[model samples]
Target: MKKLIIFCFAITLFSCNSSAQKTEQKTFEVSKTDAEWKAQLSEMAYYVLREAGTERPFTSPLNKNYKKGVYVCEACDTPLFKSEHKFDSGSGWPSFDREIKGNVAFGSDNKLGYSRDEEHCATCGGHLGHVFNDGPRDTTGKRHCINGVALKFIPKE
Candidate 1:
């Protein structure tokens, strides 16, 4: 009975550990050292992109931008979303219905204790934000909630 109890305890311990599973290391096209990233990005941008942090809601000026432009990764200038796909998600962050295909990457984020689909730049692996199912029914139902600091808007010329 004691041996069975020990085995069960060990199983439960490992099951609850988040680090028990090994994550694959991804290589990005625009790789930079920590010092280089810090020197290149603003404080908030570095926080959101490199540290996987979130900017305060409604604080991003890009949240209300309605101009026609392409949103590119601030770190590597890789186009990630088009202005046409942008919409007012009312979630205080820049929301997009779709991505610029093959320029963005998706991964599972479980930092909030629950799993969420996270989006990042494929070129630099910068943390943009989480994607949700709540979006316009007429378009793609995926709401790509992104941090404005992680992006640089390039107005159509």
Candidate 2:
């Protein structure tokens, strides 16, 4: 009787734990099919925005850009980050200290076997990049490491 009770408890515990891992609730203002995304986005943009692929370091022109502008989502043209918050983190990506409020969404990414906070366009559900703590300590103390291909820089003029 004691052995059966322990076995039942173990089964229940395992079931609960596995169910938690499967919950990934995703919702966005705009959604599209694969073909629609491919038709609208450039090849490189599609890979990073739709498939969450990373661009090579120092490869994006935006990494060296210092123009005053708004960085928008290539997929849905949603305003994401402002140039005033942009910073150079030496990470070979377009780094920002903050994003426009309510335009971005975050999720837990465990693809690398560890949890990472992945950013996405709140409107289109497009993958943007990840955020980190290693940023200018003087400011908001956040490093929004975003991909260049995933964005279109619209100058403030």
Candidate 2, TM-score vs. the true structure?
Answer: 0.88
lDDT of 2 at 109: 86
lDDT of 1 at 52: 96
Candidates in order have lDDT scores of 0.95, 0.92
The C-alpha local distance difference test score for the whole of candidate 1 amounts to 0.95
Residue 138 CA displacement from its true place in model 2, Å = 0.9
Report the poorest 10 consecutive residues by lDDT, candidate 2.
19-28
| Candidate 2 C-alpha lDDT tens digits along 64-128 | 88999899999999999999899999999999999999999988788999999999999998999
